[model samples]
Target: MNLNKYPVTELSGNGKLVYGCDYNPEQWSREVWQEDVQLMKQAGVNLVAINIFGWAELESSPGNYSFERLDEILDLLHEHGIGVNLGTGTSSTPAWLTTLHPEILPQSADGVRAWPGGRQAWCSSSPVYREHALRLVEQVSRRYGAHPAVRLWHVSNELGCHNALCYCDVSASAFRGWLRNRYETLDALNAAWGTTFWSQRYSGWDQVLPPRTTISAYNPTQVLDFHRFSSDELLGYYSAEAEILRQHSTVPVTTNFMITAHIRTQDYWSWAPHMDVIANDHYLDHRLEAPTIELAFAADATRGLAQGSPWLLMEHSTSAVNWQPRNIAKAPGEMIRNSLAHLARGADGLCFFQWRASVQGSEKFHSAMLPHAGTDSRVWKEVVELGGILERLTEVGGSTVTAEAALVFSWEAWWAYDRESHPSSDIAYLDQVHAAYKALWEAGITVDIVAPGADLSAYKLAVVPGLYLVRDSDAAALADYVAGGGHALVTFFSGIVDENEKVRTGGYPGAYRELLGIRTEEFLPLAPGDTPPLDNGTAASLWSEALRLEGAEAMVSFTGGHLAGTAAVTRNRHGAGTAWYLGTALEPAALRETLTQAAAGAGITVASTPEGLETVVRSNGDRSYVFLINHSHEEHKHAIQGQELVVGEEVADVVVVPAGAVRVVRTSTPAHPTNGLPTGSKDVESD
Candidate 1:
């Protein structure tokens, strides 16, 4: 297996580390740059992300360009021995371009045009926008083509803010072209969109307009279509800019993907194939304990794009983020613990959001290594300590890890449920997904959060919770996996819709009804304590489907309600294995029980019983690293048989660690020292 599939950088043979943080020298003078490099060396920081917001500095006018400032920054970094990921500086449109072509600005869903001020505001479908953006990329690549400090290329800033689809004429034309390319005939388009309703039939491709009031009223289908269009449109921007970089430079190219933030838009799976390396930012204000699962899932998602290659943990906060409702500092060692946790999950490198904290502007308050108070702060000290430990270790980067199970995350499913104007507005898609992840995590399963098309043949079990939108390809893949003797678990609202957010025509659970052995006749949406009038008091919610069994048997049913007698759970034999389908939203406890039962059917076993003590095993060939983290607030007892934790050599029945603590153990046969070197420490160089 390729160690690159595991997330780590090769600084030297048998000695490596994931690259370091994003360093911005634009805010400081040349004098400060020298000191910053000195501090970075002390911190063992080897990589720096630069030129992220330097578009204005790079190009003052449409044709005129300036590289003196960037040249100095790049040259100085190389001189000081720092590796840099050169940014194309196209994330935020330059003031001059936005001024000349106001149409370049993004238009919101309600058709409100966004004014310049924030990043990711460019109209993706605009030809003028693409031309200037690509030009800037070409100039940047050509000027820094062979720079020693430039190791990788970051195409643009976060793709989150672009909002993809615009109501502008340009976007409308692009959408029409996209639709035509997707479906050559008008009949195919009408059938795909179910335009038979509301007399929305099209005579020709020209009739297709921007998905807004101009073409259609507040139609959910249009809203969802616009989202898909916009995401693809922005992907075009990334692809265009990346193509220029790839042509000019040999360095791997990537953009910081904010997956969790854009749950409603920016489809990473569709754009993943284009990125040479996957990098993403992970920041969560609430549910701090469970956020690591999200990070692991994001890495898994990016790995899906990279064909199972490990992803870079690009922009996690060292402490608290200013964006959260409450900017709470990562308690004590939680920051470092979380950083290592990313590696445990399959992150190749570790980097924070900002290097030096800002004193002014929007991100001034965002957490960083050197806060506004300079190097005397706790954050800097924490970074230095972590850096010291990294300098001493060699096995952290490019090391292999392995997992036997995977979680199937579908953005198409997420979008389907998110866009639905459900009877109860509280039918949360994220909550359910998270809840399932929490259960699997608590069960001590080494889970790789992946998209639908990911290979499940190697995995003993694939869990699909709330898979509302089941693309035909995905359904076939899952069906084949189960038929091949692999176990599959699917929940309510799943297999009901296609990729375009259109409901499947034949019965409930749509395409996979046969595999699942159940067919839904009607949906029963219940309130928060009112569950189908069943005295069983089983917690169920917003939407419940009354299913009819075909070749399967029911596991549970509503004690009362119009559809009380319908099968709530069914199991069907498909191929050499089985498919379990849930017909309603089961309460967390019940879901956990069901998961335990299903996992048992698939031959999965938990390592420990404590909550928040998560473990992920990643292997490369003959070696494996087991990451055991206790993320709870209290100390816990934990033990696993036949594996030795390399952090502190001790074989025992139980181990104790403080809250929010983490440890990495080496568990290879003929156990070698965790560090490759017998004498000296690892040499960390800034890239």
Candidate 2:
């Protein structure tokens, strides 16, 4: 099966990096709209996403719609040579709809109905809400479907961003209906949810409800199923609107996905297939110790969700976002670097939250292309500069980031891995996945974040981190991948539970024990702040497991703790390849060393990267573009030679990448030297 098939090249007419922001003409007057379009043209903006939250403006009352203002704005933008990514205006319903159908409002787990103060307050499973939302979408699509300015159909702003999970009665009924479709009978449902425990078995579907607020903890399986149902419910809503849009529009349809590993609301892996063009709204978690790395991780995951195809960066901050506590503004030139970073990954289009800063409302303080400081500000200058840079790099569109290394990331595993009764409460699924990804990223190796069922034939190494929930088919796929000469690194806590969150019988790491050639007898979860020594002089913390090797050779053993002398890491030769199992979490340095050693065994070359520098290569079969981003405070010299695409200058010998700046080099020759290192590179990887 060819998994990497879909590719969405251009939503706009031109094959250039789309440069625009969310244009909310309703928020401004007619005169300001003209000025906004003039300024947009000055900045070389080509596409603007409009009508994201215009439901209240479009529909003032039930069955009463108005489009006079919107029509004028669209015509003005079209006259200015700007394309429109038209939003369906269903992200938030009007107040009148909620007033008439109070049940459309979502309720909390404690049964308190959400008020109409914020957006996305409508229950996704409410048939009333769906009907009204679809009605609005149908009206909007028919109005602007074939308009000259319409380039893409943005279904809703960010589906399920605020209300991914709802415990209202409407949602409960929908959950019961979804469960019936999945299990068919009450007995099967009971078995899947393990309802026999605590005498919670249901006699009929009506007896089951969403895992609501109870005196005690709810059933884990029940909560897990609800999570699935809630994601699907939102997906169904999106699909309904998209279907209506397709009935009237011929443009590509999409909804901006909040594709963050931290947000466990909707599984984007399932949602990607429904989108005509994959679009993502990413915001950096400024709280992380390494925020840039997290941004890169999110970008890679977004590209992977698009099946390595070009995607749209639908929304990002121009400077400080109002939502964060501190709301730190971007440093000088940081905006361009950040935008280029996303472009380096796979984003063909670049857009911000809004074209102009809001004068009022919840996001008033949020930065935009035109901030409150006006066009004379540094933000405006940078936005214009980025537009010029994007115009010169039009060839970057439709390019892809290829990788020989793959990391298996599953939302199902993430949902089940972080249960309350886990061996270690501190074992965060995304943290572990990011740890492995960061190690590889810092090594200057590009990694693809793939699903469990993705074809592994193209990758040289596959890394599975903390895969707690393993389906039978996924396990078999991994085993087959390794048996067919693919290297795999399976970490601790993997293959322990099946799809139903049930512990696999017989042994720890159950389904993989035979293929991994190791049997984990017990889990040795360490105390907080405790770091035990490993045989390699590295420390292990968070978790450790007692493993007895069947055919695997012990690579690292515990030097202390209760499981002393046990294999903390092992390697087994299966068929024509090898599978390494780490029974414990190692320190970052130790993990890097282990990964480097395994990668070397597979003959995969690791690029020697400098500190605070990220290197990514995008290829289009004929040309390769090397993007080197210096995320440090000091200037760094790189021995990369090529035509710098951003500046249109030929760099033959060494290039000085200023601190917090980006350099894009277009070259026909390979970026790395024959020895897997750039010319005159200082850093070297030693085994």
Candidate 3:
């Protein structure tokens, strides 16, 4: 299927997976390059990304280019039979460029310039910055375009990692021009942004600025639009370089996206199509209660961005990352489990942050493939072992992940819902979304995290949690989807506003009131730590709504608190399907059981799984790869009859997975008549 979509097979693997990390030879001397290549060959590394932050090294002064060291490094890697994922080395502005044009540097929302000590210092919308960066990109592309070692071209290290939004005068001028293109007249602009609230109506285009430090909270719509403008500005800068790269090179080009718990700058749904192949950089956040769950969510979201096609895991850590407040070292076998977990979700290429550990830099203490402890350490052993495992499982490459459900996720809603005023400050945008995902995850169900406006027809069940904003057309499309035989489970604090952050105005949860067949007058938010019991023998917390049923029937009612005896959860029978509504946050087990029960007519089965085992399947029409990641200490056995690719054994009826290790089985794919996706019961794993 992807052959028609993508003509290149190097990134997706012909017979071997891409196994390596960001190899920054510029950080080390020429004496270490040979040793690094030897170690890479021993570890089964085939691809290494180089020159990611080599802006200063490649071009020391303005318009002066030097590439003797890069030429030598590329030639050496080619001699060692390793392919290169080349970078344009334009992620950070060079020191001379910054000194020449200090105005090209980015500024914070409160008007403090981000200086040259860090990377991504240039303003995204600066024409001066773009002219210089594009010139460098053109030079790099022309020089290495036909080089034998080049496989893929990396546009930038991470496009919007630090500076997505800038508040400088140049950026302000760009923002006004962008608004002019969006709204032809000032009257339309004022109406859309609701600038009439604080005498902020713009009589002239230059009067409108970014939602910077204001007296109080600025207009919510203006803030929302500024976020939209900033995301577009970043995308435009990327497109400029991509156009230049395409002119000289035919390699598939992409930039690593930060799809972790934090770093929510660019709305990736809008930027997904512009990329040749979707690649992500994910690091585990140590602060969350369930960090592994967040990791899985991030991986699944990346797969969704690729539209179920196999994607690349660009950057992860070998052990502890240096950036976290308390950098916890991964356990003895934990690294392999994490890497395989991403592969199970649909990552074709597995790479880490760096090939070798740095001795002097900001990330000097960060872990790497070759750590400070050298090759005799546990981290290095696991790295080699994982590389071998990846080599053995090349059959899993280019396989699409199977999904039967959709979890609605929106960055626009994440921007608008987290604004100053809400019914409760305790309720966050991702709290309920993650809770819903965790419920499905514990039940061993797979879901595609889609946008608010994505098509729900391909899925049987759709889950929407805290989708606070919805345009009328998208809302109507969702209602039509449910009416035409799609099951939906929507939650509270959803459909409260339009695109302009304006209230939908009829009732609370304004957009979906009629579709849900429920009428809610107001919100009944409890204080922190108040877990109220429900009539169905479960408790809820954080938020509740006082509702009256129009056509829906109450499934669960509140037993206590001010909104006593009101409906806490409801089920409405629409035209051909059902709609489930939740008004309060339920416990994980309670939510799982509810979702499992609500999935009756949704064409997918929700089955129970083992306590600490995770299962995922990827298929390429002829064969299927089942990845069993055991996170617990005990070995687990599964009734699978296939060749265990990891251990290189043909098992009859059972496959044994060791503690904290991963096993992938290559088996015959199940036959499906309509969509060819795996669907049935627990044994087939559509569960």
**lDDT per residue as tens, model 3, 1-687:** 121154223753344777879999988888899899999999888888998988889899887899999999999999888888899998988889999999999998899988887889999989999998999999999999999898888888888888898999999999999888998899999999887786787888878888889768778888888889999999998888889888988877888999887877789999999888788998888988788888999999999988887788988998899888899999998888899999989888889988999999899999999999999999999999998898788777778777788899988998888888778889888887889988888777778889887899988889999999998887887889899989999999999999888898878778889878998988989888888999878899888887889899999888887778889899998889888899888878889888877765576755555767787878787777777888878887777677889989996777787878788887775523212223331332222
Question: For model 3, what is the alpha-carbon lDDT of residue 680?
Answer: 36
Q: Of 1 and 2, which scores higher on TM-score?
A: 2
lDDT-best of 1 and 2: 2
Worst 10 residues of 1 by lDDT: 678-687
| lDDT by candidate, in order shown | 0.71, 0.84, 0.84
Q: After superposition, how far is residue 560 of candidate 2 from its true place, in Å?
A: 1.9
Each prediction's TM-score versus the true structure: 0.91, 0.96, 0.96
Regions more than 4 Å wrong, model 2:
1-9, 670-687
RMSD of each: 5.6, 2.4, 2.3
Model 3 bad stretches (over 4 Å): 1-4, 7-9, 12-14, 671-687
The order of the candidates by lDDT, greatest first, is 3, 2, 1
lDDT of 1 by residue, 242-360 (tens): 77887877777878887773345787778776766777777754645456677656565566555556677778888888876778777888887877777776676778878888777
Cα lDDT of model 2 overall? 0.84
Clashing pairs in 3: none
